[model samples]
Target: MTGPARGGADPGVAAAFRETMAAVCAPVAVMTGLEGGLPHGTTVSAFASLSMNPPMVLVALDRTSELLALVRRTRRFGLNLLGAGQAGLARRFAAKGGAAKFAGVAWEPHAGVPRIPGSAGFVGCTVAGLAHGGDHLIVLGNVVAAETTGDAPLVYHRRTFGTPAALPEVSG
Candidate 1:
C-alpha cells in the first residue's frame, strides 16, 4: 500500500521546501566562459537538456550574477559535468570574489570555449537566446561541440555531495 502524501503550510515552509528539494539528487556541473580574456565560471545544478532536434541545452543563472553578464556579452560558454573526484573544482568555481578559480584547473579550448579536462563530459555552445525567468535568466544554447571521458559524475543530494553506486539488477 502507498502512504499518504505529507505537506503543510508551516511558518518555516520555505526552509522545509528547500530541505525537501535538497533530497532530490542532481548531477553537478561547472559552467565556464571567457570574458575579456579572463576566465569565469560557477558551479550549477540548474543545467538541463532543452531540445534534441536542434541539439540545445539550457542553464539558469541568477540575473544579477557576474557570470550572467559575461555570458550576455560573450555569447558562448562551456558546460563541464564534474567527475566524482572533481568536487574541489566545483567548490572553487562556486566561490565568489577576485580569486581565479581556473588556476590549476586542467582545461583546453573547444570551439573557442574553455573545456575542463578530466570531467565526465563537456559541451561547448553558443548562446541562442535569453529569457527572464523570475529572478534568474534562462540561457538557451546551441551546441557546437561536445566530448566525454568516461568518468562517473558527481551528484548532489540531501545538501551534500555523493556518488551513486550501482544497484542490483531486478528481474520481472
Candidate 2:
C-alpha cells in the first residue's frame, strides 16, 4: 500500500531501504480486535511497552486500516503475541475482507475485548491515547488485565515467519 510520499528519495532507494530495515528487525506480535462485532486484526511488528508505572503498551496501526477505525470507535482492543505455531492464525487474520477470521480460532471475551486462546500472551487494553506518526497511528493502551500461556513466540524477519533459534546468553 502506498503511503504519502515524503522527501524526494528515489522510490527504488526507499524500497530497498525498507527491505533492509525489515531484515534487521525481528517480529514481535499480531494484535486482534473486533470491529462492529466482526473479528479484525493485522500482523504488526511495531508493538512495544510504553510505560510500566501505569501499565501501558503501544501498537502502531496503519491509518488506512479498517482495524484502526474500529479501535478508535470502540476504545478497547487485545494484543495477541503470536506463538511459533500460530503463524496460520496470523495469516488468516491478516487476510483482506473476511468475517470468518475467528472461525476455529479459540477465543474468549474479556471486558468486551476478544482475546485469542493459545497465544503466547494476551493483554486487554483501553485506548488511552493516540498520535499520528508517518503512515501509522501509535495506539497507546492502558493495560486493564493480562495473561500468559508461556508459549514460544513467533518471530518474523526478512519478510518471513520464524521461531527463536536460541536465547541470548545471560551476562554476569
Candidate 3:
C-alpha cells in the first residue's frame, strides 16, 4: 500500500487508520441511553476498562453519533456486552437509524437506563468525564451498577463478528 502523497498526510490516512484498528480484536457492545423517553443504542467495539479504584469504564463514539449526543444530554448510559449468540443484535444496533432497533428487543430499565437482556454483561453508569479525540469522543463513565452472565463474550476482528477462542484445559 502506498504511504502518503509527499511528506504531508494523505486523504487516505483515515482509511488507513481504520484498516489498522480492524486488525486489533475488540469486544462487541451495544451502548444504550434514553432520549425523550425513548430507548436509543448503538453498536460499539471501542469499550474498555479504564480504572479499578472507583470502577470506571470508557467508550469511544463517533463525534456525530446520535447515541453520543443522547448520552451527553442524559448523563447516563448502559453498556451491554454482547455474547457470542448476539451477532444479530449487534448488527441491528450498528445499522442506520431504524424503528426496529429496539422493537421486540428484550431490555429493561435499570437506574433509568435500558439494559439489553441476554448479554455477556451490563454496566450502568453516569458520565464522569469527556475528552476530544480525532473523529471520536472519549466518554468516561463512573460505574453505578453492573452484572455479568456466564456466556462467552462477542468479539470483533477484521470487520467481522465472532466469539473469543477458548484455551485448552491444563492438568494440574
Candidate 4:
C-alpha cells in the first residue's frame, strides 16, 4: 500500500487520511446559526442528506466550532449551499469571523435563519441530535424548510475549490 497501515499512532496516517479525503469532490457550503440574535457562520464541506422520507440532513462541525455552540444553544441552523461563483464567499466564511462575516454580505431572514442570496440551495433546520465522532461532532437535523435556484454548485477537490464538470458524450 501507499501510506501507513490502517492502525495505531503513525503520524503519516493523519496526513494520508487527509490526502485521501482531499481527493473527494465535496460540495461547499456555509453552516449558519444565530447567537445573541446575530448571525454566525462557517464554511464546511462535510454535509450530506441522510434521509428523504422525513427530510433530514447531517453536517459535521469541528468540536471547537463556535457555530456548534450556537446550534446547541438555539437548536437551529441553516445550510447554505454555495454557487460556483461563491468561492470568495466560501473563503470568507471559512475565516475566523463571528458576526463580522455578515457585515457587508447581503442576507435576509428566511424561515428563522439567515439566508444568503445567490446560493445554489438553502436548508433551514432544527437540531435533531448530536453524536461525537473523533475530532468532529455530527449534528443531525430535521429540515424545516428548503429552497433551490438551480445554480451551479461550488465544490472542493484536491485541496482546491472547484465545480464538477459533465463527462463527454459517448455516441453509439
| Candidate that scores best on lDDT | 4
If ranked by lDDT, best first, what sequence of candidates would result? 4, 3, 1, 2
Q: Residue 59 in model 3: shift from native, Å?
A: 0.7
Report the lDDT tens digits of candidate 3 across residue range 1-172.
Answer: 7676644567498679779999999999999998766888999999899999899999999999988888999999899999999999999999878335898898889877889889999999999999987779999999999899979999999988898887999999
Provide C-alpha RMSD values for all models, in order.
Answer: 5.6, 3.6, 3.0, 2.9
C-alpha TM-score for every candidate: 0.88, 0.85, 0.88, 0.93
TM-score-wise, the better of 2 and 3 is 3
Task: Tell me how many residue pairs clash in candidate 2.
Answer: 0
- Give Cα distance to truth, residue 38, candidate 1, Å: 2.1
Mark the regions of model 2 whose C-alpha exceeds 4 Å error after superposition.
1-13, 167-172
Consecutive 10-residue window with the lowest summed lDDT within model 3: 2-11
Model 1 per-residue lDDT tens digits across residues 1-172 = 4333343345466567788889899889999888666677899998899999899999999888888888888999899999999888878888885228887777777777678878999989999999887668999999998888888889889868888999999999
The alpha-carbon deviation from the true structure for residue 38 of candidate 3, after best TM-score superposition, in angstroms, is 1.3
Residue ranges of candidate 1 with Cα displaced over 4 Å: 1-11
lDDT of each: 0.85, 0.80, 0.90, 0.91
- Which digits, one per residue and each the tens of the lDDT, describe model 2 over residues 73-97? 9998888888989888777777776
Cα misplacement distance, residue 119 of candidate 3 (Å): 0.7
Error of 4 at 163 (Å): 1.0
| lDDT agreement of model 4 with the native | 0.91
